[model samples]
Target: MADLSVAFVGKKLRSPIGVASHAVLNEGLSGTEKETEQLKAYSDLGVGFVHTPFICPEEEHPKDAPPGWKFQGIRSREPFMMEGLLVATEARRIMCRLNAGLNMIENLKENLPDDVAVIANMIGPGADPDGWAEHCKSAEEAGADIIEMNVSCPLPASEAKAVQEYSTGEMSEAAGSLLGDSLQLLLPVVKAVVEECSIPVGVKLTPETGFPRIIGFAEGIRNAGAKFISGINAPITVSPPDIYKNGQGKWPGMTTNPICAALGPWDRFLLYRNLGTISLFVPEIELAGIGGLVEPEHVVEAMMLGARVCEFSSGILWKGTDIIKESLEFLETYMDRQGYNSIEEIIGKGVKYIVPVEQVDWRQEDFIATVDDRLCTRCGRCANNICKARTLEENPLRIVIDSRYCIGCGLCQAICPEHAVSIVEQKHPVIGISVDE
Candidate 1:
């Protein structure tokens, strides 16, 4: 039998899937009763854990601005993309929700057959370390098994002190990614929480840190004493405006351009960038995969890269809570079929093949691309796109390969819309100049 149980951040989880802290969990305005039911529903569905909504120390901020949500469903055949932005207020996280979340945590802990860990999603209290520590402590007191510092939220800062902190890079005074990206500002907060909390501490990272820089960002937070890392939070982005009207296209009516949080499948590669990098470079940091996980297979992919646990936000919003059961079914079946006894066996399996550009030895000569004339629709897509190695023949009016420049990269084979291209073994792998074959 496949054993799906694994230790995440030192806490035992029956399954690696969990509900992420997202907008829908904000039950303060809608009322906590609904949110509690949502938590119970997830626990009942076979999820190993449940993360509470983002709750701040202060219920209301002195400076408050509502970050609105905007979504655009791109029309295409590519993997589904629902690009969006969230310009919402973290300041509005009310005490009512926090109280409700606390109750849900306690109730779920007492009732569930197998203990379902409740992770509290908390925002920083700006520059106040004591206040921030107390906020995390509050979650711990509320029966949270883990406290996740939500430093990576996509919303901007809204308070005077937070705005001043944002001025360093013109970031949001809102304490999400604005605070998470700041090494100086965020480190102190992480240290405070780690020192203050007896429970496991984790930091949710921002995708906006950009690549290369993310390497240092993860290391810094780990050094600050965060027990684990869960990412990637939504990216801060601008919606493309309609050129005709010179205004951004959104619901209700076209409004002036505003920076908003971008979420969905497009962020998958970005998730790998951080998870893989941390797994490869910062081997000690336990990672939780978050972004771009719409389907069940993505959970396997993240674990392959080195994530102990995984969660999905926009996908669950689109697909509903059923994604949890579907994901669990897929993971268990995958484990059994792959002949793995435990989830730990698969984590970081793919990291061995991941190499830096300098270490990559491009095998250039074993093969060359061939055009299958029968399958060829003679679609100009490959010829036009792959100028690097393919050329349109003048006399034969057929596509031919320039082996000298090809390097057998297979771009032409991949770009062919008609599936007419394939790479075949070369009898003699010669030094390339140009063969008009």
Candidate 2:
């Protein structure tokens, strides 16, 4: 069997797959117990690591705050096909207080298997360098194998009302994405934490930081002495409204739409963006892929794109602990089949193929669209509407391709439903002058 074991930031993890930081169903002061149980359950499934729900530095939470989680496009029988989820929870209801978080870490360390590392997913006093350093030091003291700075939770800036209030200086701190997006604000915190803590410190970055900006963020993080970067956290957005109900909100209990977190499969591309960009430009720091990964194959895809570790948040919520088990099983089988003996062999393997558009050799003349006449349904979906290179003829009600104009765009092949259209290398080159001539 192929070894799933991999070294991540000086720690040898049993597998590259683990759980991401997310809210749990626990409530009240004893919620830490529930979170601990959940982590234990994940460890029992043979996961390499598990992040505790976002833990803040506060010692106590308010008594009356509310918590909620709702989804859109959810069919009771098939829950996996959700458009997104709205996570609106007060600190009292979702996060672990500093004391509870430390205890949870201690409990998991004692009970979990030796290979299962307990990562502290900590949200510090936003943008406070010293306070952030102190908070992370506590987690390290509590025996966390790794400290993932929760600067990308989306909650602090997700609410439109809160943001408007924050804009006017009514609120002191809008952390999470607000912190992750600003290198000036976050770099000091990262440096402070790295300086204070003995364990590996990583930043869970926000999706709001895009392309060139994220490249700068990664470079700054590497300079700050942090070991790795994880995320594209669920981006903040308003869920789709009910068009049939005069634009009412689609969440289960709400009539009004509010800005919230978007998760699930839609996040995979953004995760790839982080993994691929940082791997190419800022190769010194490692990466952990999170956001939009929902299947066993998605884990491998992240690894191939330069993610050393892959974590699932929405996938676990939608599919249960079996997601981890199935992913581990698939990884072992896939590695053996593909002749890979260790996880390092697959990490960043696909990154070399990624290139700027200007560098791509379009190869427009090498291929053309071909339709298998036997399987063609004579559907004009491709030719009539989209591609000028293909034409529908009435003699036998057939679709024909004009290779001279095809350009090998593959629009016709992509639109065909009958499995008839294919883009294949042509026997004759269209662009080059005839050698025989």
Candidate 3:
């Protein structure tokens, strides 16, 4: 049997699956009672660890705040077509929406299983060392096993400031992505928090950095003494306006378009991008996956991309803690079938295959897509949305393979509903793999 246990930043986790920090309108304010209950529920469900909702400097947000979590699945007639959800709330939900994070951390430590660790997702006031250091110390004192600085949240309190400097090419020194994107500002705080806490410190990075630069951000965090990098909080987006409400944004009662965060399933790819890049470039720092993860399979995808731990937020909101159970059960069976002995064996296994676009050596002469006339129903389903390769023959009323037009990209084979299209070895160099080894 393969062991699922994984070591993250010096802490041994029972499994790599855990819950990401997110708002729970109930206990985020009053105290750690409800938050503890949720943590215990996760522990009972067999999660390896839990990240408490963001705790911030007391001045981050008001205690009695508006309802923060409002999310719903979005899918159109085209299923799986960029399927994802939009997340919005008051600008500040940090420190569990008013500095209740420490209490929650303490209570969680008391109620959760001793082996089930708690990660404090604390945010500070900009890049203030004293304040950020204090938050880290408090969480460590409260028995947190890890300290996760909330530098990358899309909807940080300083959102208004972020929007302005984004266009000016100067970032504001405020909480959230603004601080995460500004390496000049965030490195000092990372050093402060890392120095203040006895527990491992991780910096959650924003997706705004846009690739190659993200590698630099991870390197900076590692140099600043941070132990881990959690890839992605969420991507910033503008809510679409409602056509019926005179172009006002749709939110049931609201009619104004607001910039919000995009969360849930689709963000998984973005999470992978960060995870893979950091794993490949910055091998020294540990990596965690925290976006677009919904299904049990997504956890494996993240792990393959070199995530030491993977968190569930929208998945737990949608499917409950049972996702944890389902994931563990699936992992045990998957590991056994795949002949894995431990999680370490597979971590970063995919990195060797993920070369940069320019480094790929194309093998174009291997195979070209062909149509099996016996299987072709002439439904024309394979002829849809083909950018370079759409081979359709109308002579005998059946789909035929035109090698001249077909680049053998496999788009036709993938989209074929009738299973008529397939790629086969050809004499000439025609088929091109998406990533030629």
Candidate 4:
């Protein structure tokens, strides 16, 4: 049998399958009692550390707007619907909506079982490192075992915008302009929190920045005496279509807003890349991989790629909390079957499998797309959506194959709503992969 027990945030966890900070545990203010009960249930089920919200003293709505200013907060007007529900009074609900840290911690102490380790997640602009550090001390006093500094939220809410300047790429330049490049702003508070608290501190990051920048940032945190890293939060931006219909007939279709903070399949790949890069610098640092973990295979894959722990959230939105227990069961079975005795033994086993650029073939040759007209609805959905080659046509409701323009990338086939498109080998002259060798 594999030993799933491992240490994280200065405490030993029963398993690596831990819940990501989410509304489920916080449950707004209205259902604080129920949410605390739920946390206890998760602890009994043998979960690792339980993460809470990116805590701040208060939640303020953005006042001055930028050109594309969208509301950024736990409750945003974005179309990505979260599936959990809460039962709470209007006032308590509003309080929970405002100061997540105060309310969530108070509830955890009042209700959660003593054995369950609580990880308080803090978020704000890096400019307010002292304030964040003070908040960390407060959380530690409130029985928090660890503090997770959130620096990677994608949505530009007031807090996110405040810290946006410190992010990678253009965002970092913006941040430097606002606050100089010393990276000293975060140091004072980080050092203060580490000195004040008995627990370990970890920083969460995103993959949007280049590797060198991430390494530099991590090195800075490590220099400040932080203990671990948890990151690559929701790397890709997904623009899911609006499916709701209003009373005014078909609702006007607004362009799909990039998923503010949600994670999906695309994010998983980015997390893998980021993990690979981080391993190059701090091979021994504990890493908690977050975003887009949907199945047991995703957990195992992340572990193999050098993650010491995996944080999950979105899968529960798509499936349910039951998925947590099911995933753990699956992982335990997998570990047994693989003949591994512990989670650490399998860590980084899959990193070597990541193929370098030299192993990839960039040369393109030939392939063909064949549409089964029988399944064709000719809704023009596929043709209009992604047919960059413009080879697809409409009317009698059939896609006319233009071999000259088609590169056979299968974009049209993939977007076809009717399952009418297929890419098959061309019987004529082989042009691409078939022609080579």
What would the TM-scores of all predictions be? 0.87, 0.91, 0.90, 0.65
RMSD of each: 4.0, 4.1, 4.1, 8.7
Which prediction has the highest lDDT against the true structure? 2
RMSD of 4: 8.7
Which regions in candidate 3 have their CA more than 4 angstroms from the true location? 59-65, 93-99, 164-174, 372-377, 384-391, 394-396, 418-420, 427-437
Writing each residue's lDDT as its tens digit, candidate 4 over 330-383 gives 888998998988887877787765666787553334566666666776566655
Off by over 4 Å in 4: 24-26, 29-31, 59-103, 106-115, 124-126, 157-189, 235-259, 352-356, 359-437
- The TM-score of candidate 3 is 0.90
Q: What's model 2's lDDT at 355? A: 91
Give me the displacement of residue 288 in model 3, in angstroms. 0.7
Q: Candidate order by TM-score, highest to lowest?
A: 2, 3, 1, 4
Question: Which candidate, 1 or 2, has the higher TM-score?
Answer: 2
Clashing pairs in 2: none
lDDT of each candidate versus the true structure? 0.75, 0.81, 0.77, 0.60
How big is the RMSD of model 2? Answer: 4.1
If both were scored by lDDT, which would come out higher, candidate 2 or candidate 4?
Answer: 2
Candidate 1 per-residue lDDT, tens place, 275-315, comes to: 88888889988999999899999999999999999997888
After aligning candidate 1 to the native by TM-score, how far in Å is the CA of 331 from where it should be?
1.7
